[model samples]
Target: MVDASGRQARGEPQGELAGRLRALQELSGLGVRALARDTGLSSSSLSRYLNGQTVPPWPAVVALCRVVRRDPRPLRPLWERASNPLPAPPKSSRQGRPLPRNDLPRDVPDFTGRAEQLAAVFAAVESHRVVSVDGMAGVGKTCLAVHAAHRLAADFPDGQLYVDLHGFTEGRPPLDADSALRALLAALDVPSERVPQDGLEQLAACWRAELARRRVVVVLDNAADAEQVRPLLPGAGPSVALVTSRNRLLGLDEVPPVSLDVLSPEESAELLVRASGDPGGPEGRLARDPESAAEVLRRCGHLPLALRLAGARLRHRPGWTVGVLVERLAAGASEFDTAFAMSVRQLGRPQARLFRLLGLLPGASFDEYVVAALADLPVRDVRAMLEELLDAHLVQQPTADRYRLHDLVHQHARRASAEQDPAAERERALGRVLDYYVHAAAAADAAMPFLSPGAPPTAGRPPAELPPFADKNAAFAWLTAEYGNLMAAFETAAAVGADTHVYELPRFLRAYFARRCGTTHLNVLFERSLAAAERLGDPVRLAEAHSDLGFARYNAGRLAEAAAGYEAAGLRVAQAGDARVAAELALRRGYLSWDAGGVEEPLDLFRLAGKLYEEAGCPAGAAHAAAAEAWATLQLGHREEAARRPGRCWTSRTPTPPGRPR
Candidate 1:
């Protein structure tokens, strides 16, 4: 291939250019973070460039070459070619696509009431191709949206997609617009390399473009507001979207919405009986005691979730009359309290304890292993306990092995745990959860080490066992799935003054963030970690924290703040007398200096780093520093002197380094 500069390139422009740029990075012997620090590029962006997932701008290519003293002019032809590759072929209009995706959660079998509301949703969809269902918590917003999507399935034959935005989920933050857009695009089979890494507007445009060529239905559940759901709507297409939120989404003026309320008294009575499986005969409990049945409906507040829990309790007890159920629920004030308290009261002590502890869980949903950790029980025993909770309708089994509590139920459980469990017991349970995540994250980080050449020592006590990660892929999958929960754990630990955990947890997520999430969240985490480290007053940890914060700032292009961090870290490292940390610090300091436009000072820093690494018995680190010095020498046009350094450096590590693990 040839560019307008009339220079010939070989192989695919993007892939080949990425390979050559990667070679330059290897020649300097710097990890991805180190390279990004010196190049004034975000680590996430640089990672994407090096992995051939994205094409860097011309200036970025020049920056990389300048660091290693490679001639940028020679690579310009290839960079130009890569920058303007032919666009992808247009997708056909769903004529021969794969089988339709059915990601909607299983529709409730005993779906009672909401007849008018369902019809309203259908009417809105017919007019706008988008309709939102808004209601209070536990009022069946999600149920209505999913039911409508399933019923309208034949109209949009391409696929059915579902995304739980986690707007009001306990412990987890609302899913941001960018992450939500990425999920929606991925559900439509968009390739990762094709998806934009930054810019919510760009991702949304791509999502709309993709949807325009197909007929599909998407259920966007638990949206925080209109801004979160607006970008996900289809543009001028037969495809439709159904959004569910607790509050009215006034911002989505183009999309009609159905405002839902609690079931009518008659509808509520019918639902309670149907869900309880009481026969129509006079011999049944509902028929035998009309007054008590009405009381049960009142106690449930005519809400669907509360009614289901109440019905499940009655269905499981054959001997109990309607009056007995009412008496058990008579003490609570709110519908959630009445229904959730009665259901939780029926569990054995062990199961009840597990249910209460689950309230402390920080993720949107969890599997049995996390349950085991939170309850400090054996995994096998935890499975049976979770089954019992699911049977009581206290916990929702969204998927086969993943479960979550309804929002109202979660609030009730949290309240009950605070009332019943002691402070120390609650603290210990949450500590176990922190330990579980830190240990598992560290293990997963180990299996798929990123540009982490000088990783710190792992912290936190490990649990009795951890889920096995068969390979890097499996490890990453686990990390991605648990990311929200892990963040929640970090926040919980920090809030409770678990300083050690607060400082240690973010260390494992750096590589993950560099690949999937952007630097914004990573920067927040390291900032908090820095605070926790200072509180602990451990010089080594404090120094590491400063260095980590500096690295994050450097990636964010905050050079002045990054310099301040590095200076503080140097003082702490000197006090701690840790040669390994001192060497890493020196190496990073050198990169920062180089990026700040100093040619000679950075070389001196590199030499000092190599000497310190040698003294610390870290041959790899010493080699890395030596290579950095050689590259700086070459950048200064001292080719002969630079040639000798690599002969020694090459023996310590592989010459052709692999791409980022992610």
Candidate 2:
């Protein structure tokens, strides 16, 4: 009996088939020759079968089964497997082939999460000849690919080959397809002289031919794009190739692509704990403060590379708490900056400039129009540049028409902007964004009548072209989507001494804040507006600012502060000669006084405000003051006076309801 290679099998028949055959022979209580006689087969053939050196023909096995009184069914499957062993590589192919190289980087010891991703990759390689893992820089695409490749190494016995293509490396051009193929050829043990010194197609053909019958795993890391990776893929066979890149590599649609995102919060903490070297030490301490640990992870953007760097930093600095590291990262001093820079450096000058300007944007995300406004570029150009940035993985579109920078990438872009862009240019870009936001908010406010019925008018000229919105719903949606950014723009305006914008932006937002019933951000926006108004020292604006601040404070239930704010605004109201506003301020102060148990004082203040409002031609304000006086009169236990005051003073309109003051 012979093996698949046509050589005589040596040694005892091995594995399950050998054991079963030997058992049957023993059960027959016969030596090879005796078994052969009993089974009607030649002695040498029986000997070979019994030794697992060959598979006997079915009739011969049936004769043996009868002699041994054993079943042939169960043994037949084992017999088949033993008979058809996996084929060996041709002698010539194996003679000078390079030794198998286990070139994969060490798997991350504290690698956390990604079970689903790993399974997807494994499943993909089973059917697809090639798979690519892609994601933003520092998102751990290479790490994941390497780990999965190592798990699958045993299936491809010819070798595991790896090459770094330098796709996003700083100060270096990406490895071209021809050069990558040569490296792969050399790894496969094709002699240096034999590798074709020709075009990429010829070299790729030779590489594919070499892998035609072999089962090998090739990993091409940091690929710049599909073009750089195309020649490195092996031809159809048992071989598989895994490619990792920051770019999406959409050009390789034939190859299944798995995109990696940042780690989840829980997995991120686990990684930090495990990578910290002493989970029971500082990491353990951090575990007790999950909020702080979560903050650390958030500041790190839950990115594995950032987490690893932070974990290592914490591991080495036993004296430092996780909060310390969090503060550092929050201040934008992160190891991830270098990794992010590599991706940025790959961008074209226009795209890089857009990326830098995007970092200056106050919100977490923005639409193309906002970007256009900031960059002073046409909307179409902004959209195209954004697409370029998206393809490079420096920016991500979390949803349709909305692009956001990863926290870490945002930090890097900010740093790059500070370093590369001049101070004046940064300020100018920021000014443009603030101006755009102010005008856009005003337009939205104007379109939504329910929100701005009695809202204060903005002081600036209208923008030449308002941002397009289909209707009130679209306007409200835009406001809601950009609420945080609007707040940031308000604060930034104050910081940069854009005093007119500072005071004007909040006026447009005030109605939105009131309509949404947003107290927290309202307080912040008005406070910043007050500061800006104070800097300008315009008493009319000051009165408006103080009135807005008092309103926010009053809603927040800080009655004493609200009263003081109203009182301060009253002093400015007379200077500004707005008696109607003065009446409003007096009415607000009276409410605070009534809430604080000063019934008599509040009644007197309300009466005085009512007289001033009537004189200033604000009958609604006069009636509101009258209603407040009636309420104060009732609170003072004078039911008759309260009833009489309501009849005589509230003739035209009812008072603004309590807690509904705006």
Ten residues in sequence with the least summed lDDT for candidate 1: 653-662
Query: TM-scores of the models, in the given order?
Result: 0.79, 0.43
Q: Report the lDDT tens digits of candidate 1 across residue range 276-336.
A: 9988678889989999999888888899888888888889998899999999889777778
Which candidate number has the best lDDT? 1
Candidate 2 local lDDT, 169-203, one digit each (tens) = 53235666765675577567676545664456778
TM-score, predicted candidate 2 vs. hidden true structure: 0.43
Alpha-carbon shift of residue 575 in model 2 (angstroms): 1.1
Model 1 residue 193 CA deviation (Å) reads: 4.4
Clashing pairs in 2: 13-51, 13-52, 98-189
Model 2's alpha-carbon lDDT is 0.72
In Å, residue 455's CA in model 2 sits off its true spot by: 7.3
Candidate 2 minimal-lDDT segment of 10 residues = 651-660
Candidate 1 residue pairs that clash:
none
